[model samples]
Target: MSRRLALVIFPDFQLLDVAGPIAVFEIAERYRPGSYDLTVEAVEGGQIPSSSGVCLAARPLSQGPLHTVMVSGGDGTRDVEGLQGIVRWLRTVEVQRPTSVCSGAYLLAEAGLLDGRRATTHWSRTDDFARRYPRVKLDADRIFIRDDDVWTSAGITAGIDLALALVEDDLGAEVARMVAQALVVHQRRPGGQSQFSALIDLGGRTGRFGPLMDWARANLALPLTVEQLADQAAMSPRNFARAFVVETSTTPAKAVERLRLEAARAAVENGFDPIDRIAEAVGFGDPERMRRAFLRAFGLPPQALRRSARS
Candidate 1:
């Protein structure tokens, strides 16, 4: 008999939260035939509306004799009253069966399953979730977290990563690697991590910093310093530095470094340029420095990124 998986969708659910994990599970099915039987279930029996007002047809929760159950998060289900039924149903989940929630960890909290467990949720909800469920040890910085059979992800997209991890654990690392490859995702992202690099934070780049980020992106090859960037923002170096950090959630040096690193990674993966030239173009000054940075950031040197990207 194949394993059974259920995805619980509710009103105002983040559609990607529902889609990404389902896609991974579906892809896993392709590689290992008859591995799973999947269902999209709702706390209600049918036409549970989404945040977008589109009615999503789903099987009811009672249909599950599930090997794994996923609770998807959306704006519709965040409040305590909105998630009351799902939270109650979750309390009855079979202990031996793994129960995972995507961005829906907050719903789990409402029912008190997370009372003493270490967990994660969308970073934006950290303060509120902590306040609401004081006993749940929340790791706001992680992409996803797993405590025994209960797994939770940080936000919408991270659920896909978390689901792939569960697939890896259920089957094998190799199968997970293959699924990631097929999905065009980076392989082997461990649970309890930040999916997006903090270095890629383009936060608060709303005004002049916005166009400046475009400028920086375009001139990734140039030596861009704080003074230079400040001049472009038409502010004193000190003021610009403060504003940039406040807006970008990172220093000017770190932002420039990340852009250059991204450029170097792209150049490496494309196979159109040599490592030395790519390093120099991305402002690494030399291959050795770029090699070290690449190794540190990607766990692979330039050549390895090229090889893996090509393969």
Candidate 2:
């Protein structure tokens, strides 16, 4: 029996948000032959223009026993004040599973579908999303989150990762791997992985001390004391300490430790260097220090992360 899969979109919706997941299921159908019947839908049932200015024709929202229903997100979702019709429609739809990509969670939340559910969306919208939907437990760091029948993903590309996970669940890891290979993506990224890189999350490039941060990342093996960093930024030590906290929301020492931890983790996961050598190269000084840092940051030691990466 073929499962009915509907992808719901709206005007100015993200193009990839719709295309990525559709491609996943389409490929899965090729593998399993009659596995899925796909449809693209919109509130008005016409030519819907995406945020990218590309238009996709869609059918009007209809009620039925759907196997899966997915909603996409974009700038159109930011101010959903005028979307009460679609919100009402979403509130009344019946499906075995409901999912969202990116800010699409906003629509689901607006329709009261995500109330008291664990969900995630784009990291950059964490603050606003929390304020708007207080009942939805928003875990901004996750790549995707699933609470029972409702699945929500973060940002744009994370949609593909979420779809891949669904493929794994419906088919198996082997089918998921084949789909990922066809798509030229990692087989699956753990949902718990941080949405952004450590440096980017720390505001390394956009913050006031961005240049110093860039230099610091490249010189992780050097002694990156607060005083030394202050000198590089041309500020007094005390003022620099205050400014660093204000800009990065972390102490200078903690920031340096985070940078070193990122570097050491990459080396541990991707290279054959000894633990002690990786530790020293990333300024952790010794294996024990690196192990402790990894435990604090990732709740596991360096060895565990490497083993997980291999498996």
Candidate 3:
């Protein structure tokens, strides 16, 4: 049986958000001819301009059963929440599964589809998304999330990751691999893989503890006690802990652990160093401790991450 795949786009929608997933399903169809019948659509139906100025012609929102419906995200989604017609159409759509790429989760959230659901979006929008939609469980670190029949992915290229996962779920791993290979993607990153490590944003920290976070990231191998960090930030330990949580949205120990985990995972995946050596170098002290940290952050042990990276 052929499944109908509908991609919903709006004015100023992110181009790749629509193109990437379409390419994945299109490629998958080559492997299994007629596997999918694809359509690009919009609420009004016409040529819609993307954020990049490229235009995509789309059909008007049609009434029917769709195997899957995906919504694209961009600056336009901010306005989607206020469009009564579009919002009403989204609320009324009947589909076996609904999905969103990047900030498209905003539209789904606005339509009440993501209430009490686990979803994710562009990492930079995590705070705003959480603030606006407190009903949604937003995991900023994930590459993508699938709760029941709904799927949501992080920003930009992560849409490709989500499509590859869908292809895997429908046609099997072999077909998904072929699609990924044709797309020239390195590998199908697991959904559990983090979008990015928090350490990378330390330089952009705006709080009074900005320099302290930079120092902490650089000195991940050190003990990095709260007192030490407080001294670095020129504040009392109690005040520092309180303020740090308010500014960074995480505890000092957790921040340090994330830094260490990021560093250890890089070494494990990209270098020839043994697990114990990597652990010690990253302040994990022992392989067991690093293994536990890896499990907590990535849902995979160090060895498993290493093997996946190599494979």
Candidate 4:
């Protein structure tokens, strides 16, 4: 039986939020015939202009049975008053799986569907999302998250990852893998994987710690204790720790660990080094400790990641 899935959109919605998932489901259907019936929907239907100025033709919001209903996110979500209709519709929709991509989680939250549910959205919107929907457990560090029947993903590209996961859930891993290969993307990134690269903003809000971050990366083999980092930054340990968090939005210890992970992962995936050697070079000191860290942060062990990377 084909599962009916709808991609809900609004005016000024992000284009990829809809397109990425469309591509995933379309590819899956090709691999497993009659696996899915996909539709693009809007509150009033017709042509909806995306944030990038491109427009997509959509059908009127349907009251018919659907297996999954996914809402796309973009600048349109900022207009809270403009989306009341969607909020109301979402509240009454009887889809088996209610899902969202990026800021679309905002609508689900607005409709009260995500209340007390573990969800995720774009990393940049986490602060505002948490403030607006305190009842929703927002995990800022994820590509996507599923709480029972509700699924939410982070950012535009993460939508592809979310759809690939749904394909796997419905059509098995082989079909999903073939779809991913056809799409030229990873077979599937675990929902627990961090969405953003920590290196992108290691310097913090003002780039005040840029030099320190670079130095830490270059010296990942050394123990990057707070005191050692503080000395390098020319500040007392206590004052440095306090200021680091205030500036970076992360503790010094966490920042160091992220830097090490970034370096270690690169070596693990791109080189033929032993896991123990890679772990030691990245300051993890022990192979088992690095494996645990990899599992916690990536939902996969070092060995599994290595094999996936090579495959």
Q: Clashing pairs in model 3? A: none
TM-score of each: 0.77, 0.82, 0.85, 0.93
lDDT of each: 0.76, 0.84, 0.85, 0.89
Candidate 4 residues 152-226, lDDT tens each?
999999999999999998988888899989998855878987765553345876678889998998998899999
Candidate 4 structure, TM-score to reference: 0.93
Q: Residues 1-311, candidate 3, lDDT per residue (tens digit)?
A: 79888898888999999999999999999999988999999988899999999999999987868888888988887775555566677788888889999999988888899999999998767899999999999998788999999999999888999999999999999999899999998678778776654523453235566677678878888899999988988889999888876666567887778778878888998999999998888888989988887887777898988897788
- TM-score winner: 4
**Top model by lDDT, which number?**
4
Better of 1 and 2 by TM-score: 2
lDDT of 2 by residue, 26-139 (tens): 898889889788899988899999999999999988686888889998988977986677788888878888899999999899999899999999866777999999999888
Which regions in candidate 1 have their CA more than 4 angstroms from the true location? 62-66, 95-102, 111-120, 123-150, 181-208, 221-228, 236-242, 245-254, 286-299
Which of the two, 1 or 4, has more TM-score? 4
Better of 2 and 4 by lDDT: 4
| Winner of 3 and 4 under lDDT | 4
For residues 1-311, what per-residue lDDT tens digits would candidate 1 score against the true structure?
47888888888888888888889999999989999888898777788777777776898786455788788887865576867788778778653444444558878788777789988887556668889889999876567777877788877778888888888988888898899989988765556334334424443434447777678878777788898888877989999999886665457887777678878887888767888988877788799998887765556788887887787
Candidate 1 yields a Cα-based lDDT of: 0.76
TM-score-based ranking: 4, 3, 2, 1
lDDT of 1 at 100: 45
